[model samples]
Structures are given as C-alpha cells and as structure tokens.
Target: MKVNIPWVVGLTIAALGAAGLGGQTARVPGSDADPASCAAGSGRITIATGNSTGVYYVMGGALARLVNGHTDVRAGAAETGASVQNIRQLVAGDYDVAFSLADAADAAVRGTSPFGEPQKIRTLGRIYPNYTQIVVRADSGIRTVADFKGKTISTGSPLSGTEAIATKLIDAAGLDELDVNRQRLDLTKTVDGMKDGSIDGLVWSGGLPTSALTDLYTTLGSEDLRMIDPTPLLPEMKKKSAVYDTATIPKATYDLPADVPTIAVPNVLLVRDDMPANLACALTTLVYDNRQALGAAHPAGKDIRVDEADRTAPIRLHPGSERALAGLTSR
Candidate 1:
C-alpha cells in the first residue's frame, strides 16, 4: 500500500532549508520550517541493539559513537531482542534508529511476517550481509546442515530476525522446527548453553568476525567447533523466504576447513516516517561524510560509504535521505 502524505510536506522542507533547521524537529525540504526551533543535541538517543555478544550490539554502539562524534547528536546503544523488537521500539518512538535484517525490514514495510500491520519506516541504506552462522560442536557429527535433526539448537530470540531466518533455513533443509530441540535465546545465552552442553548447535544471523562468536570458539578451544556452510540449502530457503541469498565468510575468520558457504540477509538503518526531513537528511549525510572517522571507531563502520547509502534491499528510500544523496552528488 502507498503512504498518504499531506500536500504540505513540500512547503515544510523548503522552509527547513531557509531556516537552517537542525536535529529531529527540522522541517522537510520545500516546506516551511517549523517556526519553533529544534535543538541539535539536547537529548541523547538510545539505540536498541541485539545480544551483548553479537555484532548488532557491537555495530550499534559503534554507530552511536560515530553519530555522536561527528554531529551535535549524543547517543548510546542498548542490548535488545533485535529485529522485531528493534523495529517495534523504533516505531514506538523509543529508538531513533535500528539495526535490522533485510527480511525484517521488508516485512515491516509489507506488513507481513510477524508484524500485525503496516508500519511507517524508511531505510537509510543496506549494510553488509548477516550470514546465517550454523555452528556445531565437532563431536556432534553435524557436518551437514540437515544433521540438525533431533539436535538441540538455539535458533534465536523469539520473533527475532535471526529466528525468522533460522526457522526458514531449518525448513529448507527438510527439517521441521519440531524435529529439533529449538531453543529461543540471544547469542550470549546461546553461547553459554552451547558451552554447558545444553545446546548441540546454533544458527545465528550476524556479520562476519563476530566478537562473541570469536570468544565462544576460542573459549571452547577444541577441534569440535565448526561453522557448517548452508549454501547447499539456498534454493529451498528462497522458496520459503525470498530474503535468503548466498554469501561467503572467508576462511581467515575462524581458520575453518575452507571458506564457509552461507545464506545472507541485508541489514538496514531504519527511521520513523514522522521524523523531520532535515534531521533525517543530516543523519544520512553524517554516515557517509564522516564514514572514515566512524570506521576508526569500529570495523563495521567501514561498511558504510556515500557510494552505498542507497543499497538497502526491498525498501524505499526516505525523501530526506534522497535529498542528502542528491546534495552529495551535486558536489
């Protein structure tokens, strides 16, 4: 369904440019800037991140630091349930922005998947792929993705993007959710459970070189831990969730048998529809303008660039974001 925008947005944005609007309350371009004012850094925005041990937490924190460092924007990242929760909080106006999987972002826009209705969200850009990380204890004999039958696996937190991807992958592998001991938990808890022998395997969707996965593997310190490639089931996965695609995690990451074949979903930085255009444009500009500085704070930040700010999949660009890109290209 198309969004119904009032005719006044144009005027609001034009005014924002004239008034030198800044921050969340800035006006949309072409419209009259709000006669009132928007303070640039009056409040701190809290980013709802994923499991503390996961990439979402790491990157979310990096994003907060990145935005804080370059603009008059102060921010912080907090551990959350990820995806579904992140989107919900963002729409609820609790989170200024979020780290979400492409599947979840599509679902949010289409009003499908776990959402009850359509939401007003816009994409900043698609970042790197979050590979479906299928990890198994070496002794578990899970050399193949299909070997997860009857095994205890932590798919992901309830209604989480990871869980959504994990379930589809399981089904594509010809295994039903009921066929295995499906454990719903975050990455930290999943790792702890794996260490304690409570879980036989785990399927997580995250960026490459996750610090938590690194620590988990290092702490396990045995030949038994392995990253099982999932590309073998890609065709079937697509049938279930079109969001799935093929990607590879380099062998250098964990020193595995070879490069790991995996299923990946894009990541997005989302914002609410009601947000001020100038502020949204500013935030989008900051990500690309100060990308190098952001990268210095965290490796994930390096994934961002002016060249890729329009890369988010299956979602429309925000008008403000488009304006920002237009300004960049005009230079």
Candidate 2:
C-alpha cells in the first residue's frame, strides 16, 4: 500500500533540519532527540504485517491509516511472512515498524538461531495475543503431535511465528519434523489443502476469529474438522520459552462444540533502535487515542489496552513510546 506524506509530515521533516528558536540545532541527525523538543518529527514509514488473511494485516492497515490520517507521520503496511521475517527485514532497514510475536521478538533481541546476533530493536508496545490453532480432519487419526509423524501437515509459511511455534510443539511432543510431511504453506492454501485431502492437518497461530480458520470450520462442518488440544505440551514449551501462555478457543468463536485449549503468545510492534523518540511517541499515541477506530477495523484491536501497551519486557520499550504512555496515565 502507498501512503503519501501529508504536508504536515513533510514540513516537520523540513523544520527538523533547521536551527531551533534558541540558536541550538533542532535535532542532531542520527541521534535520539528529546520528545518535547521534537514534537514535529515526521517522515514516511512502512509497517511489515502478516498474511493477507491474518489479523496482523487487518490491524496493521488500520494503524497505518491512523498514522497517515491523524499524525504528522505518514505510514503504510506491507504483507510479509510475519514475526521472524518482519524482524529480519526491519533490522535490514526494509521497514520502519514491524508486527512480530513476542517470543520471536525476544529471540531476535537475544541473538537466537534465526538471528545471528542481537538485533538493535525496541518495542512500541504489545498489541494482542495469538492463539495456536491445530486443526485436523476428523478421520486423520491425529490425536496428538506424535500422530503427525507419518501424516501430512501444514506448518505455516517459513520464518513465520506460526512455523516457529509449530516446530517447538512438534519437538515438545518428542516428534521430529522430518518424520512428518511438513508442508510450508500460507493459511489460504493450507485450508484448501485440508478440504481437498491433500493434507491431513495444519497448525496456525493467529488472533480470535481468524478469517481463514472460520472459513475452514464453516466449509467442513464440525464432524469434518476437529481442533486438537496442544495444552499437553505447555509445560515443556514454557521450559524452552516463557512467552507461551494458556489460551482457549471458545465455542462461540467458531461455533465449535466446545472450547479448545491451546498455547498462546503475545504480539508486539517493533522499530529499529535508531527511530526518533518523537516519531515513536507520536505513533504510539495515535494508536491509543484512535483505538476505537482501530477496533472497528479489526476486533483484535480491542485487545490493545493502554494499560498493557507498555508491558513489552525482555525487549526494551522505545523512549518515545514510554513518553507517550506516560502522557496517557497523567491525563
């Protein structure tokens, strides 16, 4: 998507280049500027979101619109593989803001496997939680992760948080991914593959009422589609990463016969460490102030509480974001 910078954002950029009223530089290039001193900070930014059918895509678009329409900064969102890929691209300077799973964000900051070294990233805030959905055909006989050994399964797009969690779940259950016919596919193709019997099951991590999952259950009917409980592996998963939490897929969500137990992970918005404090503050405040419009865009936005907005730990919060959050409380 394209977002044209408003005259205000362009003007702010120009203003930041000039001397201040006190004869001091308005802002030193490439240095973090005080939020109070740089109220007019503005520029164009791209937000890396997830699959087209996912909640991140919807909420990200909403956020981009808010930034462009309300703030001095102009922004747009792009569809990506989600989480891991978003972090990598953000660090590589392909994007300015990124939506990522909290676990992946932690791994990136800690210099884990996918990331060769610690990435210089900071969080704007936590957004929402993603429920891990493991859907299977009723007759697939996939009672547990181990049952997937000889069966075909979709593990989400490569480098996505879904794939990362799926791999962890399989290993937690003492099953090797190599033993399963793991197909790396997106939500749309995975749903189609399940319907056509091309695959037996698929694992997905997404917000409640995930559009693609809803379509799967509606098209296949309860008897044809079943959700396997992954709660059994929670202990082991938490051992590897503390980000795993217990979550439920309520019957009302997909009209299922019962609530399904699953693992959940929080999602976060990230930016490079060098992002100006003023821009981060403006972006963060915009999301909080116009949250209702965001909720209108995607119900998941309801989970974006100001109280929880500053709870991005393990990954440090940007100074600008902290200032924005502070203003929320003072008001």
TM-scores for all candidates?
Answer: 0.83, 0.89
Lowest-sum lDDT 10-residue window in model 2 = 7-16
Q: Write the per-residue lDDT of candidate 1 for residues 1-331, one digit (tens) a residue.
A: 2222221211222343354544557423223343122223333455667887777777776666655655455566767789988899889866777889888888898888688888899976666668788898887878886898988899899878889888877888888778988999888898988888888999988877787788787788547698888888888877755767888888777666678778887788888876666666766776777667656655666766566668665677777788777777678
RMSD, model 2, all Cα superposed? 6.1
Please report the candidate that would top TM-score against the real structure. 2
Candidate 2 shows a clash count of 0
Q: What TM-score does structure 1 among the candidates reach?
A: 0.83
Q: Which 10 consecutive positions of candidate 1 have the poorest summed lDDT?
A: 4-13
Candidate 1 stretches greater than 4 Å from native: 1-44, 329-331
Give Cα distance to truth, residue 242, candidate 2, Å.
0.9
